[model samples]
Target: MIKIEDITFVAAEAYKRSGLVLSTDKGYLLESRLAPLARAEGYPSIEALIAAARRESNDRLLWAITEALATHETFFFRDNTPFDLFKQEILPVLSRARGNMSTIRIWCAACSSGQEPYSLAMILEEEKARLGGLRFEIVATDMAPRVLEKAKAGVYSQFEVQRGLAIQRLVTHFDQSGDQWRIKPNLRSMVTFQKQNLLENFSGMGTFDVIFCRNVLIYFDADTKKRILQRLAAQTASDGYLIMGAAETVVGLSQDFAPVEGRRGLYGRSGAAKSAAA
Candidate 1:
């Protein structure tokens, strides 16, 4: 069994780096996720690995552990409702509201392995004619370098492509490579991937017309969730929308966003947030 102190150390480190609140009850996750890392890093066991990390003050190993614990199991068009809302509702409104502007910018936070942003790119490509020459900028950010590298390459295994991706979309936007599929260059070019820790300030990134921060806040504590939501509000355009995970809500935690009626996970900037942005 891993020592309680070691588990506590991991939980503390995860919180410090990413604001992730790893509960003591879920300590088995450390053993399951970090066991491979320990073996690959030449440690005999997870306990030995943690011992070495503590003894050496190994920031790199600690970061690796945190990355391992982070949930990266995302697929294309995850949870169809949000993407449907983006294409059907969000786009038309933004097109009219920003007709004078040249571009519509979308931010996909915690974009693991590029699927979410790439899915958006495909929708934008399909709607280009309707948009009347309006350009699109998709900024995809994740804190893990390993997933960022995979996202940049734009390659996916057959099973990965099959998940949440329609066959027609697959044929149109990807080229088959052996048993793997690679997202075409046009779709790949639409997104710019960066390593960003959501715990830090996003001021340098500028405002976004749409922000997809789905399924990420559930990992953080309530206070952390409130802080991130407030920052997200500041970085959203006054007329823009925020799409979160269906299971996540900002009801009591924040007043920066108010839900768009009839839309499960869609939110519009509140009056308070708009005033602050002004």
Candidate 2:
């Protein structure tokens, strides 16, 4: 077992670098993650791994540590309700408002393993006739490069596919190879995956009409969540929608956004300075 005090400084430094909060209560989780890395590296224990990490300024160890801490357990259409709302309400509004733009842009902020964006692609494909002259782009991002690579591959096992995908959509968009289903080339082309850290300024990425930042903020404390939500607000378009996980809400965290009633996980930016009585 590693002494909490010995690794506390390094843990704090790691948290500062990644914006992932760590506390003594989560020590056991760290131990379980580090144990495999320690054995693979021939280190005797978690303490030895920490000492090795501190020996030099090289970031390989730090990368491994951060990767271990990242949450990567996401699947296609993880929750069905939000997707239902998007198909029924959001897409129609965006398609109409886009007019001659010919392209619809969406961002999946913490797209782990690629299921979420791919699910969006299937939805877009289903409505292709309605969007005859329109193009669509889905930008999927995450802090973990390893998972991004997997997402880029667009392959899922039978168990993963059965989780939330409908049998009809599966037949239309995927090809079966043994027990795995591989998303077709056309569907894969609609999504672009990249590495991004949501905690930092994202001004360079440009604004989006819809941002799906689901189930990601639970890891951050209140202050961090507020900061992240503010940054997200700045990057979202005025009429755009922000969809959070069912359990997450922007209430008390932000006043810039207003909840859309009857919609469980939807929010829209409050119009900016509703023009003074001209």
Largest lDDT belongs to which candidate?
1
Q: State the number of backbone clashes in model 2.
A: 0
How many backbone clashes does every candidate have? 0, 0
- lDDT per model vs. reference: 0.91, 0.83
**Model 2 lDDT per residue over 1-278, tens place:** 56777558556766766677778667787787878877977889878877878787548887777777766777778888889878888887777778755677799998989999999999998888887687887999998887889899999999999988889989999999999999999999999999898877778888888899999888788998999898999888898889999999998998877787778888888763121111
Local error of candidate 2 at residue 220 (angstroms) = 0.7
Task: Using TM-score, give the best candidate's number.
Answer: 1
lDDT of 1: 0.91
> What is the Cα-based TM-score of model 1?
0.96
RMSD of 1: 2.9
- lDDT tens digits by residue: candidate 1, 158-239: 9999999999999999999899999999999999999999998789999999999999999999999999999999999988
